[model samples]
Target: MRVRKLTFAALAIATALSLTACNDEDLTGQADPSSTSTGSSAPDDAGSDGSGGSDEEGGKGTVAGTGSNENGEIGKCRTDELEITASDATIGGDTEGTVAVEFKNGAGRDCALAAYAGVDLGTDSGMISAERAGEPVDTTILKDGKSIFFGVTYPMNDSGGSGVRVTSLVVTPPDETKSVSIEWPGEATLPVTDGGGSSVKVGPMGSAGQGEG
Candidate 1:
């Protein structure tokens, strides 16, 4: 009987030790080093790739039709926002006459003007063939209230004594459809011949204060 009691006591003590070990482990809350984290491992609002925010929300990048002049530099100049003017016509020679043309940006932003300005002597005469006089000019950027200038040289005399009758000059800015008209100076007439293959020449556009041709 005493031996049976000793065995029972030993068993009870062993069971108590096992329970205590389990309770200690539970209290410590140890985690396996190799186990992956179960809590949401997803990325935050910035996105995992790192490119975040939008111009629409006033964040990084340029907003459409607004922002710094550098950002708007790609936008073409609009006709409605441009102010076109022509200097007094000058007779360079019996065959050639030159006129200085200026385009001012009246819009409240910066814009790009490129290529050659389309020139028309009259409504029915169609567009006159023109070529750039010199090397290609750098792309012009016109800021608000700024202006760019170029020269247009045309024939002053046709095969006959009569010169090209130009009542008004129609001008179109580069890369634009809308055109503006300036009344031809009464003293100047192009010497180009009727049905002749002669062509007018235009110089590269440069900033204001550049000498006129």
Candidate 2:
């Protein structure tokens, strides 16, 4: 009976050790439901790439229609904004004479002129339109308080009896309908028939030195 008690005690101790090991394993293996996760869920930074470098580098490039000009807008010049005048331009080159016409920008803003200015010589009979001379290669910008120039060419008549007598000039800006009238600088008689072609012709608009005179 003493030997049986000894074996029972040994078996009880072994069972108690096995239960303690199982409780330890259960405590370590199970995850806590209330605790936060270790993995990140935040969004990536906008300026940084994954390699820790920035995505953007420099300033913006130039945009369309925004040039070096002030006010950043360019449009056709209007007739009402101009102060038109005429003067006697020196005629020296090929053969014929030309009248220098200048357009001053009194409008406090900027504008542009392309192609020829429409010109008409006012006579007692009717209005005679002058023909356009050259093709427009560039758009002339008339800045605030600036002036643009062009020329009106005509055949110089040694014998003055053939052509219509012109007393005033009715001028119109490019791509404009309304007209402005200025007195003719000198007496001119533009012929109605000059070798079956138009007698009067106007050239393209230009800056100061590039004018016809």
Question: Candidate 2 regions off by >4 Å?
Answer: 1-73, 92-95, 160-162, 192-195, 207-213
- Provide the TM-score for each candidate, comma-separated: 0.62, 0.62
Clashing pairs in 1: 155-191, 156-191, 157-191
| Model 2, residue pairs in steric clash | none
lDDT of 2 by residue, 1-213 (tens): 999999999999999999999999887666442232322222244226443342222212233224445455587889989999988774466466677889888788888887688999887757777898866667778888888788887776656576677889989999899999998874477655644766778888862234522
**For model 1, what is the alpha-carbon lDDT of residue 184?**
60
lDDT of 1 at 203: 71
Q: Report, for every candidate in turn, its global Cα lDDT versus the true structure.
A: 0.68, 0.74
Q: Worst 10-residue stretch by lDDT in candidate 2?
A: 54-63
Model 1: lDDT equals: 0.68
